[model samples]
Target: MISIPFSGSKRNRYKEVKQIIQDNGYKKVYEAFGGSAVLSVNLFREGLVERAVINDYDRLFDLYPAYLDIKDTLIQKCLEAGFIKSNKRLNATQRAYLQSMIATIDEKYWRLLANNFVFSGKQTGSLKPLYFTYFHNDITTDKQREYLQTVQQMERVSMDYKAFLKQYFKDFDDTTMIILDPPYMNSTQKAYDNRYFFGLSATLQMLQMVKEMQVDFIFFNMIERDVIEVLKVFGFQDFEVSTRRITQTSTSSREDCLAYVRNHF
Candidate 1:
């Protein structure tokens, strides 16, 4: 899979999460917030699912299937944007160029650059500080080429999860499952602008709808009061909670209940 740098990517937990899906014997999979397409691509690559569908509100996801069509141009442009090189620190002119390039590059390339290079990999709409000197060496032409092979003509939808399910949930059968990683429960309003952000009420509503449909689901989130209450109301009793945090050069544990709920309603 192409290693796109993404903030809050579930890359670290993919294996653990995939095991839950495997144990549940879901033949068809849908990732509701397909961030980085990490889980979706891995499932497809490993032949773990008969069909995998990915959807997200992020605009960049719309261009994923087209990565092959523009891979070479994007690589050259990334080189020009200084992502293919090392610079532990940026000089004034280099910073100025990046600040200006933000407006000059095509939207797709800009999205790629910002998401991959910016500090924390945030969608800041401007050139934020660089994350570090060098991107992972794996982000090379060969990698993109291989990733294109996996994503080309793959099933994907760019829309809100609610609307997406409204249109497509009936297509799923008992063998199908939804894997969800919506924004954190206490996310700031700005962080989850309700436009692209799935809020708590929306999440609760989706859970209700999924229970009604009786499709199995695997959900990832932080354990907050409302989440626990919702789980109680839905009659879901299986969940795992742990503390996980990662930094640039270190991994640390914190005191919090990071929840994983597998609801076989």
Candidate 2:
């Protein structure tokens, strides 16, 4: 079993979010975007969140993480993906054949489609990118081993936020803190890397619902044209805190864009 270090993600903002929740005397926390679940895992680890609800639309968000109670399936999915990848770098015909063979398959075969899509070069098809790419990293045996170990660990102690909420949040209101890390509208232009496609208007509608929840809230978003306009509509007059976008791949044209918030002001 290879060791997988706990590399932080955009959810690293959980540290600050945790402090805000605690300082505000919140008892229940909600992590709505739950990709990688870095926010849920870290806050739960720190014991800052008493009860939480972590939800995401992505299947991989649930399929891969231990928090979703999917531990034993990791190794199986990896194996089903088949370790003997097309090392020769499949030609167009071979790639097409593989895609044809794997498309519209079952959840058990998510690994196969994922492996061929990525290692064989993802072909265009009706199945959403997120559907096939869930197993994209399954191409390497060593990487699979590492993934299995991590999923095992995440399963062993991962927070089941949904279960926690159903049993606890029925009557909770103001004491609840909702933390949103939804995909930023500014990130809409990116398509090459693994990014879940979400309708911008739909996301805005959800944010509107979040505002109506009357629960204390915080949000993480990339500062961009669409976002500023959305925030304005939501009655956010001042930004609580802001940080510059980092990393070399974070949109060259939007390097000036940042991660900002509305609740801080």
Stretches off by above 4 angstroms in model 1 are 64-84, 115-117, 121-139, 189-197, 224-227, 240-243, 248-265
Candidate number of the best lDDT:
1
Score residue 46 of candidate 1 by CA lDDT: 83
- C-alpha lDDT score of every prediction, in listed order: 0.61, 0.48
lDDT for each residue of candidate 1 in 3-80, tens digit (9 for 90 to 100): 455524467667765786688777888878776667777777788888988885675555654543454554466567
* TM, every model: 0.75, 0.54
lDDT of candidate 2 over 73-150, digit per residue (tens): 433544464523333544554445444444534444344334434533343323443433223333334543445444
Judge candidate 2 against the unseen true structure and give its global Cα lDDT, from 0 to 1.
0.48
- What's the distance in Å from true for residue 228, model 1? 3.7
Q: Which sections of candidate 2 miss by over 4 Å?
A: 1-8, 59-62, 65-170, 189-197, 224-226, 248-265
